[model samples]
Target: MPLWTIYHPANTYSDKDKQDFAKDITDFYTGFGLPAFYVVVLFTEMAEPAFFVGGRPASDTVRIVVEHLARHLDDPDMRRRSTERLNSIMVPYTRDRGLHWEFHTYESPRDLWMIAGLFPPGPGTEAEKAWARANKPLPY
Candidate 1:
């Protein structure tokens, strides 16, 4: 189960755009065996001039970083080559230049279940319960 929480400036995106973004995320997870239903997405919109860093407005700075990541999606060596490039692009705009951002990934079996009193769990509920029992930490 992959949960995505997106936070952006208010009015920056529309409802249709949000749905399309969700579809993209769902497709990405489903390709790895996790279906759309198992993915949770939350979009939080903030007003313009509402977010600031180091006393400077975050309008242009935030857009630049997001656009850069979106542009490197098709690179075959993205994970290896684009690592340093992203950091380099973000240096001049920020207060700190030495700070770097790195991406990491992992895969594991996930379990989902529902409680009888709270909500009735549908299909795959039993499997998730069993997996939860074996995993030690039950994630509802």
Candidate 2:
């Protein structure tokens, strides 16, 4: 599972923008063989006064925290490529929009994750593909 938590000042994004951004993120994960349902994107809007940067309120800042439980990129090269791809994906949403943003990813053991009372199938497995196609957890 790739759980993405995005934080920005209120009114930074419209409903349509949020939906589109989430779809792009989900697509990125699905391309990697992860189940579509396993990619979760959450947008949190905060009041300007409640957000800060450099010891002062920053209304143009965005922060993303991501948790990866489905798999870990243990290879240095793979991690670099993944980061580059993700940054490119965010270019339009953040850099082009002039929003100062930063994101960090955390990896947890795959064994620690469960969906709908079932353990997710291994990467690239037929069972995993079924879950991806269904967009939900299913007995495998």
Candidate 3:
């Protein structure tokens, strides 16, 4: 499972923009064969008074925190590739928009992950593939 939390200045993205960005994020992980339901995105908007950078108020900085449970990049090469993919997906919403943005990821053991009272299927397994196709949680 991958959970992404995005924080930005208020009005940085419209509801539709958030929807599209969430879709792109979901697609990014599902492309690696994870179940669609396993990808969760949360968007939080902060007012200028509430957001700061380097001790100064900021309205153009976006911060993201990602949690990975289902899978992790265990090597430098894999991590690089994953970062590149994320950059590609984010350019349209971040860099291209002239916003300062940063993101970091934390990986947890898969054994700690569950959905709908059931453990998620292992990566690339038939059960996982089924969940990917269904785009929802289903008992294996």
Best by TM-score: 2
TM-scores of the candidates in the order shown: 0.46, 0.96, 0.94
Error of 2 at 60 (Å): 0.5
Ranking by TM-score: 2, 3, 1
lDDT of 2 by residue, 1-140 (tens): 99999999999999999999999999999998888889899999999899998899999999998899998899999999988888787778898999999998899998988999998999889999999888898997
| Model 2 pairs in collision | 1-70
Model 3 spans > 4 angstroms off: none
Output the lDDT of residue 93, model 3.
89
Q: State, as a TM-score between 0 and 1, how close model 1 is to the true structure.
A: 0.46
Q: Is candidate 2 or candidate 3 better by TM-score?
A: 2
> What local distance difference test score does each model get?
0.45, 0.91, 0.89
State in Å the error of residue 31, model 2: 1.1
Q: How much is 85 displaced in model 3, in angstroms? A: 1.4
Off by over 4 Å in 1: 60-140
Candidate with the greatest lDDT versus the true structure: 2
List the lowest-lDDT window of 10 residues for candidate 3. 82-91
* Candidate 1 residue lDDT tens string, 6-75: 5556665579867866776566545543334555567766566785657965543333212111112346
Going through the candidates in order, what is the number of backbone clashes in each?
0, 1, 1
Compute the lDDT of residue 8 as modeled in candidate 3: 95
